[model samples]
Target: MPIYDYRCLECKKRFDVFMTYAEYGNKTVVCKHCNSTKVTRKIGRIRIAKSEESRLENFSDPSSLEGLEDDPVALGKMMRKMSGELGEEMPEEFDEVVNRLEAGQSPDDIEKDMPELGDDLSTGGMGGMGGGLDEDF
Candidate 1:
């Protein structure tokens, strides 16, 4: 599948169309916004996918971390970028934390409001208690 950009002569609007090879030239391309058949296909810029290593390398740049600590929104943006750079999907709580930070809430405040946000389930909070699996035995 290839996406093509078209400029409508009647409405002067630009839109993208995704079509297969078989559909190309078989049907007339029309402007989606104005439904105008007087449209011309234009060359669109190609997108390049960056590798995980390259993305992580960009995240480690000193400029990327600048003002991140002082500004909660900046910190949240940085965290979002880091989450995108990672190969694996981030946990749901991760997004909630970022959203709270971006909304001008401090990490301490967020943690206090959402106690389970960073709960150390492995340590069992009070002590190094197991997952109560021993009771099943």
Candidate 2:
């Protein structure tokens, strides 16, 4: 589900709604304060934060990662298992970070000095997964 921004042409009121992709396009989103059908779609903010457990769960499961894991040791092993299943080589940096992790170094500690190591640390490292927002949340 995603939060969508909408503006009511009748009332000139802007509001947000939480709904599935299908519902977003098909449903008639009316203004909460004023019931109006003349709504226009607008881009809404996306929440990207994942809890610690959610992060771990994503790392542990190959299915969720589309098999991008390809390290023989540490998280790389898990990634490799996933990659083998998905038939793709995990990103080179992913394997490097797994090597560091296997050496018993904390990701935070490594990330402090080498920011690049933190690239794909969360989810598939698509970039900017944390909850903190640039604008006021």
Clash totals, every prediction: 0, 7
Candidate 1 Cα errors over 4 Å, as ranges = 1-49, 121-137
Pairs that collide, model 1: none
Residues forming the 10-long window of minimal summed lDDT in candidate 2: 128-137
Best by lDDT: 1
For candidate 2, write residues 75-134 as lDDT tens digits: 545544444444334443555566676665665665776675455444344233232322
- Scored by TM-score, the top model is 1
Q: How much lDDT does candidate 1 score? A: 0.71
- For candidate 2, what is the TM-score? 0.31
lDDT of 1 at 48: 46
Give candidate 2 misplaced runs (Cα > 4 Å).
Answer: 44-137
